[model samples]
Target: MTEKQREEAEWESINVLLTTHGLKPLCLVKRTDLKDLIIFDKQSSQRMRQNLTTLVEETSRQQSMIQELIETNQQLKKELQLEKCRVVDQEQRANDLEQILESVKSKVSELEDESLNRVCQQQNKIKDLQKEHTALQAKCQYYKKKRLEQEETIAFLQKDIYRLKKEEEERIVTQNRVFSYLCKRVPHTVLDRQLLCLIDYYESKIRKLHKQRYD
Candidate 1:
């Protein structure tokens, strides 16, 4: 065959092979450009699928991180509530201690007042006792002086009684001597002696009268 005819026969063979596989006939466009376009489409589809897979994986990781953060927030809120309750308990204890201290202070004040009153009363009692003691001492001294004076007067009176008794005994002895003389001389010298005796008796009477005046 000629060169053009051989070329047509090869094309006919290509067309027959495409028809047998139920493929469409090639268009008028260049084969190389067509092949390049198909390759580009396949590459674009593969890159899109890879990008979608990466995005899904990243989204799932972000969802897990968010869940963990939510759990941590709830735990922090619970701890805060417990701390508030503890503070309230401490405040109540402080209030109770303050009330007890106030009661003790009131008791101390009452005791101090009572002690002051007792001291004042004791001081007044001491003053009154001191005055009474002074009066008693003066009274005792007066009684002691009065007793000394009475003792002196009694001693003087005893001496006077002893002297008066001695005088009376002397007077009795003289009267006894005069009576004996009169009885013995009565018969013999009656007249003259009797007259002399009478005269003597009258003189004795006069002496007795003079002694009485001096006493």
Candidate 2:
């Protein structure tokens, strides 16, 4: 074939191929421009493929990081649950201690009240005892005074009785001697009268001494 016919046949084939592929036919463009365009399209396609590969790698790395974050969150949740349980246990212990403290305080208060009551009772008893002691002391003093007075009176009475006894003895001896003399020298009637008078006087003195001793 001739070169012009060959060129015309190739143009018609390109137009037919463009029409079948749903593209517009080339209009008065040179072969050199078509070659340059093909080369630019190939370079652009290569760059797009390289960018797609880099984007795919970055997406895979992001997915891996997300998976690690999920695992870490699960572990954190478990730890938080354990911490909550520990906090609850500590709170219970604190409550129990508070109750024990209250009980101790109540017991101390009761003991204090009991001790105060005992002290008051003891003080009252002491006061009563002191009053009784004072009264007893007064009675003892009165009794002591009475005893001393009685002792003095008893001593005085003993002395008087002794003197009276001595006087009576002497008087009795003198009367007996005189009566014997009268019996020998005087008459019976005169001796009897004198003896009677002396007897009456002696009886009166004895009565007076008895009255003084008793009083």
Candidate 3:
């Protein structure tokens, strides 16, 4: 039963006992019976005082528990605000990373186009060199020299292609790192840890509040 209900029941029980035992002035009682009634009334008063003290103590404890719950709720709200700020910052970073990635992609496309143009130009030069080497061979005097120059030109074009490939690979690796960093769900920061701790603390406080309410 609720405290109020229990208190009401106790008061009703006390009134019923007094009436049943003829302790009221309206009813006559023997002297011995009157003394017993007095003692019983005194003991009942003492018991009621003890009950009042316990009720006051319980009420004080509940008030403290409620105040603590309010403080904890406020703390949790502050932590939620911090979490929201962190999320906004992370979104901004992700947007910045996307912009950077787009810039890198544009650069890569430009480089690829330039490399293809260079390859076409080199192929045309190789064709011209071959024709000149044939002409030199027909002249029979500088054939060996023309052949050596054509080989060197071919080697240089190969080196340029290899260098471009390596550069493209490095760009890909950098883009992957940026993507991974942006896609991570949680930010790695003291603020995140502090927010998490605050949430846990408030959650525990809520549980304690529930326990106190039930108790």
Candidate 4:
């Protein structure tokens, strides 16, 4: 049964016992017997008072236990809230990490594109240099052939000068006439122009080759 119902039944049983016993003065033949009865009634009333006090104390203890239980429940609820907050914070951190990862991925993609473009430019520059090197090789060959022809011409001019000197000496010509005739016959201007042209051509070729090599 409920606590209230059980308590009420106990009270009723106690009242019925007290009623059956009847609170009456005892009649006896001696004053000592009457005093003994008084003492017995007083002891019974004292015992009842002690029992009521004990019951009040037990009730107070139960109230204290209930209050403590309520406080503990409140503390537990606070802890649960804190745990929930921690969970939410962790979730937010995870989202932030995801966003950061996405940003890094985007930056990596951009760098990859830029790197590819740079590689293409470098390849094109290399191709152009290769073509320039081939052209320079052809030009060097042409200039080498021309230089050989110029050397042969120079040798022929020297031989002609030697023959002219021998003829002049054999004929015993005047030095002034010989010098004037040699000056008139020699193509000094043409030789100077050819030498200067070759110098210019080689200089140009060297500069172009250097540019292509560096490029």
C-alpha RMSD of each candidate structure in angstroms: 19.2, 13.4, 53.3, 17.8
lDDT of 1 at 77: 80
Model 3, residue 17: distance off in Å is 20
Pull out the clashing pairs in model 3. none
- The order by descending lDDT is 2, 3, 4, 1
Report how far residue 204 has shifted in candidate 1, in Å: 13
lDDT (C-alpha, whole model) for all candidates: 0.65, 0.73, 0.69, 0.68
Query: Candidate 4 — worst ten consecutive residues by lDDT sum?
Result: 23-32
The residue-by-residue lDDT of candidate 3 on 1-215, one tens digit each, is: 75544655565676677567444312222244343232335556565566567557767998999999999999999999999999999999999999999999999999999999999999999999999988977777566677788889889989989987875665445444444464554535676555545554655577589999999
| lDDT at position 106, candidate 1 | 90
Least well predicted 10-residue stretch by lDDT in candidate 1: 24-33
Tens digit of per-residue lDDT, candidate 1, span 7-116: 55665675466557554333222244343232224544554455456556666887887887887778778877777787787778788888888988998998989999
In order of listing, the candidates' clash counts read 0, 0, 0, 0
User: What order do candidates take by TM-score, descending?
Assistant: 2, 4, 3, 1
Q: Model 2 Cα RMSD, Å?
A: 13.4
Please list the residue runs of candidate 2 whose C-alpha ends up more than 4 Å from where it truly belongs after superposition: 1-71, 175-215
Best by lDDT: 2
Local accuracy of candidate 2 as per-residue lDDT tens digits, 85-151: 9999999999999999999999999999999999999999999999999999999999999999999
For TM-score, the strongest prediction is: 2
lDDT of 3 at 144: 67
Which residue pairs of candidate 1 clash? none
Q: By lDDT, is 1 or 2 better?
A: 2
